[model samples]
Target chain A: MHIYVTDHNGKEHELEALEGWRVMEVIRDWGLPIKAECGGACACATCHVFVDPDWQDKLHAASDEEEDMLDMVPDVEDNSRLSCQILMSEELDGLKVSLAPSAKPDAEVA
Target chain B: MSEQEIVTDVVIIGAGPVGLFAVFELGLLDIKCHLIDILDKPGGQCAELYPEKPIYDIPAFPEISGQELTDNLLKQAEPFGPTYHYNRMVNELEKQDKGDYLVKTDAGETFRCKVVVIAAGGGSFQPKRPPVPNIEDYENTSVFYAVRKMDDFRDHDIVIVGGGDSALDWTLNLAPLAKSLTLVHRRDSFRAHTDSVNKMRALVEEGKINFELGQIASLEGENGQISAVNIKNADGEKSLPATRLMPFFGLTMKLGPVANWGLNLHENLIEVDTEKFATSEEGIFAIGDINYYPGKLKLILSGFHEAALMAQAAKKIIHPDEKVVFQYTTSSTKLQKKLGVK
Candidate 1:
């Protein structure tokens, strides 16, 4: 399975994802410029991403913990979700997400 | 200004789990210690990041929360009476001519120690800088991450951005002082305490402070002073006049100052041997998630084991002529006496 991830530079990369793996893990594994500082513990909001409008309804809703973590993010939107909370599944084979500027590594942030 | 100098047998740079555990192991060998941490409290990430999260891997306990584990570790190390210096970062480390090390902190304190143990897990926790363009330009002037003085905001147009406790608390504290105070957040709901949220709402209703639902879009400034801040919300882009701006996003770990300590680093982590867990410098050890080895696992238990081994080496360095004897806490009367169990 795979997912489409657009980085902060507006470049899209097709990443090979595994079933039951976190979308953030897949993106980080593919060498995408994501901070993902907490390593998917939902302790931080560094893995924030904007889900494509079409894929928004396909994924599960964000939990209260995830929402609380999102409160720390400076640039959040209506569709902003912590990618670490989203598990890649067969239904999300082509899950589309665009990395928020806040998700990039601190050094890479312009 | 004259700095306070402390003398100790060993100086551990980090009060995290591993550093706390090192106190027990070093104390057993008759070594005294002093710990330094950047956080106001100890436990490092376990205390700050996920204090309530249950960790499943800790031995003996099937599930233990981070804060609980930290409290237990502190209890375990209490008999040793290790001193902790919190809210300070070790800015410089140098080997003295007398072979001991001199450690200097940003808080204007110094330590002379026989050995240095770095249990710094993922480095120091620092306030996250918002990704606003050229935000660095206004730092310590028009833009501040932390409020050091309430008088700085007095009579100034202040714009605070965040929904957490720092933002709300500062909003309430600085509302009376500012010419105009605006609380901006990305969402209507706040993650701060209910009391603080209620108080902030009361201020908004009283027309003392304005609450806006939006994210900071940009900053308008000149010569390191911001004149206005642009925020984007559901309605449209809005600009608020501001002399001071504070954005409290949260804390993130960065390998600060430690990178300049002349220690060999592998991928931003200190390189250490698995045997002694010692760094490139003699009498200096690195453990926990901050140290890298061939089969290193960044687990609390792994850090515990490294602390035990590192303690033995540190003891040897501190007291070379003393004959080292291996004794288990369960069987040895000397060890039990040291643990205050006798």
Candidate 2:
């Protein structure tokens, strides 16, 4: 499926994601700045981002841990999801996600 | 209230890897520091959580656990004359008439120093709590953001919430220790690495771990302890019996009291000059994960580079003497000798 990823500076890139690939790997494999520090373990919230409002409903709902991590993200809104928590699917063919300017440092937010 | 004030050349506000690295850098410059932190021990989050976990990206070292790396960093900083105060949180920082800064801690101790470096990493980072009512009360009791002191939950049925690597890794670690383990993910697929996810899947296939693909709708507790977790899976909602809940869901980004420090905060990161790592305010600087610069790589090696450069700039600002030559440490001096650079 084609997914649109946006960087912190609003730069957009259209990339194809395998049917079940996590959004974080899609962005990281493309050499995006999303740290995914915990290596997409969902342990670190460094891969946090905001899903486009239009495709919010199309994506899977964030789990409790993802929700908790989003709370630590700066500029968090109703649409924030840790990119690692998002899995590519046919339903989210044209998903758009924006990287947050900063992931909450491990020390400050925990 | 009586406040004790002490003066030092530098005041580092963390005891983590980067903060300790600053002490080592300052030692090379022959500067003294007054280091403060809220934790009772050093290593910040590393000491608190995942001390035994292996880290592989520390430049020269192929792999080392968090504890070993912290020990090495501390040893490197010991000679630089850093006075460490534990269990003390910096409450505020005020500029003095003499151009220095007064750092006041929550414990009523005040430090007067010419420069301040914020090196707090994930320890100061707090986890986001579910928005369900009464969630805050369970913090540090039965609910926690991380698995601090794993033995605390030995033989207890623990429910870990998250689909990422942390959730999977911790589940694998705690699975053998806990009496029973439950992993709840928002989706059937996980985002963790292949090996860790495969291990978890194996455990699930063997019926050794209970895997729930869903969300935690609410948490019910009693006497300030979490008793059960309300989970809503794809099948339906169910109340899982939980003695201790470890939520690896992830961190939330909040600057806390530091937000009011008047530093230029962009998207929760402190804005600092790239070359000097200096914040908008004089005598104030940020490094490591808290500060971001253009073209900067956020690696431990990069943090060390920033610490050295920022320490040099700070030394020049604190003691601007044309005749004062920068002396290299034993390790750095050896490298310099080999490289033949003056």
Taking chain B only, the TM-score of every model is 0.97, 0.64
- CA lDDT of each prediction against the hidden true structure: 0.90, 0.75
* Off by more than 4 A, model 2: A4-22, A25-42, A45-110, B1-3, B44-54, B121-123, B134-216, B219-253, B320-322, B331-342
Off by over 4 Å in 1: A8-11, A107-110, B1-3
What would the DockQ be for model 2? 0.18
True contacts kept of 1: 0.33
Candidate 2 per-residue C-alpha lDDT over A1-110 given as tens digits, one digit per residue, 9 for 90 to 100: 88898876678999889988998889888877765655565655677788888988887677865664553343445677888888888988889988765542332232
TM-score of each: 0.95, 0.60
Provide the TM-score of chain A alone for each candidate, in the order shown: 0.95, 0.86
lDDT tens readout by residue for model 1, B1-342: 134789999999999999999998999999999999999998988898889999999999999998999999999999999999999999999898767999999999899999999988988888887777899899998898888788988999999999889999999999998999999998889889999999999999999999998989899999999999999998999999999999988887878999999999998899999899999999999999999999877889999999999999998899999999898899999889988994
Model 1 chain B: worst 10 consecutive residues (lDDT sum): B1-10
Scored against the true structure, residue B191 in model 2 reaches a CA lDDT of 60
Quick one: best lDDT, which candidate?
A: 1
Task: Compose the digit string of candidate 1's lDDT tens values, residues A1-110.
Answer: 99999988898999999999999999988989887876788997889999999999998899988998998777778899999999988999999999998787663221
DockQ of 1: 0.46
Query: Each candidate: fraction of true contacts kept?
Result: 0.33, 0.21
